[model samples]
Target: MKLTKTLTSLLLAGTMMLPGAAMAETTLNFVSWQVGEKGYGDWWNAVIAEFEATHPDVKIDFTLVPRDGYTDAMITQFAAGAPPDIVHLTSFEYQTFADNGWLEDLGPWIEKSGMDLDGWAGQGACVWKGTTNCIMLLYFGYIMAYNEQLLEEGGVAVPTTWDEYLAAARATTFDRDGDGIKDVYGTGVHLATANSSYTNDVLIYVLSAGGRWTNKDGQVTINTPETIEGINRWRTIVEEELTPMGMVGGDIDQLFMEGKVALRIQGPWINGFVQRAEPGIKEHLKYAASPLQPPLGGSSNVITLASETPQEKKELAWEFIQLATSQKFQELYSELGASPAPRPGAVNEAAFAAVPHMQLLIDATNAASAAGVDRIPTGLEAQNNEFAKVAAEEFQRMLIEKLPTEETAAAIQAEAEMLQ
Candidate 1:
């Protein structure tokens, strides 16, 4: 009797274990630059946790590749024919992957699932080569972060026009304590970093000056009168020493957080750093609308599945994506990410009361979408990285060599046209 009971208990235990073992069979890998980041990381984790709960058998293995190296790392994976199950790409870089067929097209899946994608912010950015290759999940606009105390001391208000902005920068940029050395810089821009970031920041001026990197026809327009005016404005700021020389974005951001820099323009993500700023400085930091018209912002990032992801795994990944795009998560994005969520009507006014600047961010996003602005040059989307480098080099030349703005513009124009 004892032996029979023992065998029966063992069988029950094994049966119980078998179900759980079977349930935990699937593992999906997700890679992104935002993993472990302040707001974006939390949102990603919450969505993944709920997704695993809903689909008991699946686990998401999250990895963080720093933004500076993300493009190369992802390219290496796809080249090896074993990319991550979940692929997250930045706005200007996804087209290269789509062109190479490394991304899974979701048209048939969307049809089968009957997902409603109408009026989705940045939805049009996902359409590549007549197919939906990814979801543009993080379209955003740039905002100006300014030091309230510094502006008060300088006797200036938040600027609402480019000329006013220049005047404000001039007032705040000065040598503190009567020292010959410059102490407080007026603005922070990515000058030495020489990447898409520089392009993005400078283009804010270019667009505001009534110029574009390229026209709708995909020809270089940097040498035009309006464009040169904008380029000269950037030259004026740097030449006048309103901003520090030879600093990358990271250094500049650190300086801004430390209260050494008075004003800076960046995407909504800057809010996260603002919250973590030093106690005395954080309270005085405020956000405002940029003087730049049609802010240099749109389609910041996208999420897609790898073409090499197995069919069953792809189905599971798609479910995870569905959760990410659902209304609940969309609301979470607005609250947690502190930026305008891509979904229409996702932002909560009450939730955004703590960060009053978000109202302007929303307005900026709407204006940019209506203006049809993009960070990457129109015809050079695939070669965006190269274009950025070229522009940065010429910009640095104009700053370092004190080359004439018109000459620098012509150089950028000639080099950019060669990319074709």
Candidate 2:
């Protein structure tokens, strides 16, 4: 009887120990394209460390995907029924994912937590069919970065209007070594169709001219007078030989660093690239808001629907998203990435004080309009890609085939209507 009692006592002790020893732990997978990028990777690691410290039972499994194949990889993973719990998707990809019901609707969580969304730059991109599906982490607006030395040599001040921009470009383009061949161009233009840069660059021109791809009701409005005017203006720049021919976005950056381009329209990432490639050129770099209102640029963090199977895991994923979008993390992101924060007032003033040129980017974001991709209806990723493809082809024709601006605009509009 005593031996039986001792066994019972041992069993009770084992149960007590098991309750504490078998503590449930959750692990979340986070996928991002910025894993090895200079400042971005370090900042993300720091955030993960802090989050892990607070939630000791939770482990974050980070997966780094290269930018070139990131979207395809994410899609493949989702199709395989094993998407990461959290994802960083670009604005262009957000709507498609939300439309397919692949993303979690964050509205209820935000409402329950009473998270304020006011004054968050580029937040409109996260809303799909009146449901918030993502949280914007980075916000960038198009701005013009000029080489001060080139502008000074050409005796031209910074251009603020379309006409002035053309004049400056004309003045800045010339032969430097008297070789009778122009060695430097006034601006670096990207017209390739393999990437989205062509579409984005063209949209900047269209948006600045007060043209839009669609109306508030989502009708096709690409063949408007304003759009034609914008396209014509762009053609004139090329016709005047102000930009190098057949270049892509990466080539533009290279030309700018080599001092072959006097002015280039780019986002905040240019600052980091310039600092790393040509630090000496930093002294001559000056930034200005795009001649007209620029398009918004950035990405957002989203929770995937795969996490919904388990309520606890879903809640934990949401917690991480909240932590990432919190003001503290936003400030850290802006400081380290040199990009503008998604939310206004989330940037550290002292950080910008050291790089005053970045202030122009902040101001531009405040004054910018939504990008073309953001303005389209949800679930139209395929249609959108088709539209971009057609538009890019027509744009290339305008540049190389010398197609008339009206014809190009009409072609794009017809393609857009066909998709509709």
Candidate 3:
């Protein structure tokens, strides 16, 4: 009787094992640009942990690639018909992917799943032709970090208008050694490439001057009178007013580190680096909102996200993106002083609580978010950058060498047509 009971128990165990074997495992692969940097991969891991905990039947696999080759790598993977289950797409690169029919239509997913994409600042960037191919994960703003002591020494008030900014730039620049040659520059011009890489600041300038890149019909309207004038103004700043820093396309981040430049229009990622590099400069540092046109006619500042992802994974990508761009995550990032939230309400309370001056930035973000629009980052991105480069270089050459404005404007126009 004991032997019979043992055989019956063995048979039951075998039957239970069959069901376990039949259960299928679902694994989702996520690709992002986070290979070399330490602590950068933490967010992805945290999200994965949260996702795995909630969905026990599914698994997540993360693939970190270098930021330099991120877009190319994604393209290669997507072309193989085995793209990742999720991808990080920048606003600037989204256009190329959308143009190629590589992305999935996320409109149905958002409508059916009831995701809260409306509150995010980057929602516009994710939408192409009224369809969302990817969800925005974060918002990064670029501002000029100024040296307070130097400003006071130069008797300059913090600039609010373009005129004030130009004057401040002039006052900030002077030869410290009393030599005929000017040794120090008041403003730094990041005259690298003009593409999406080099145009964020210019975008701020153009928009502040009431320039628009496109009409409601999604046609390229880059050659408008206001745009031409805006480009001319940028050229003037680079050529005649500010000292040229000559930072390469990808080297702007490093240039701001040395603190040699008095005013650097750069991103928030450099905040911690500056504090660590020159602890004494903490009290002396201040951030300025990008300049607005006088008489209150400045358009909102916008950002470009570059990404290449496929359709099937877009739904999951949006969920992951929502998590990354949520108010909770934005505050977490703010606490670390990495970057601020893309949305107006997100991270603002904590940001203002941490630093009073941050209120201005938050206000600006709110205003901009309310007014901003999203456009495709066409393949013309490279052309635009090259055109800006030529114009900037020419403006610099003319200003430093005292060339004519008409000649500079002509060169800028000629180069701009090539971008079309």
Candidate number of the best TM-score? 1
Tens-place lDDT digits, model 1, residues 1-420: 445747755765576687554322579999988887778888899999899888665789999888776788899999999898888898799988988889998898888988778878888878876889888788877878899999988899989899999999999988888879888988977776678888777888888899999987898899999999988787788888889877877678778888888888888888877877989999999988877787878888988898888988898888888889888998888878888788777887644874577788888787887887888778888888888988998898777788888999999899899986
TM-score of each: 0.91, 0.81, 0.68
In candidate 1, stretches whose alpha carbon ends up further than 4 angstroms from where it belongs are: 1-25, 177-180
In candidate 2, stretches whose alpha carbon ends up further than 4 angstroms from where it belongs are 1-27, 38-42, 53-69, 112-114, 174-183, 239-241, 293-313, 369-382
Which residue window of length 10 is worst by lDDT in model 2? 370-379
Off by more than 4 A, model 3: 1-73, 80-84, 139-142, 174-184, 215-225, 267-276, 293-319, 325-327, 333-345, 369-420
Query: What is residue 391's positional error in candidate 2, in angstroms?
Result: 1.3
Worst 10 residues of 3 by lDDT: 294-303
Q: Write the per-residue lDDT of candidate 2 for residues 231-341, one digit (tens) a residue.
A: 777677777889887777767777787788888887776665566556577678777877755553444343333423366677787788788778898788787777777
Clashing pairs in 2: none
Candidate achieving higher lDDT, 2 or 3: 2
Per-residue lDDT of 284 in model 3: 72
Candidate 3 is scored at a TM of: 0.68
Comparing candidate 1 with candidate 3, which one achieves the higher TM-score? 1
Clashes of 3: 15
Highest-lDDT candidate: 1
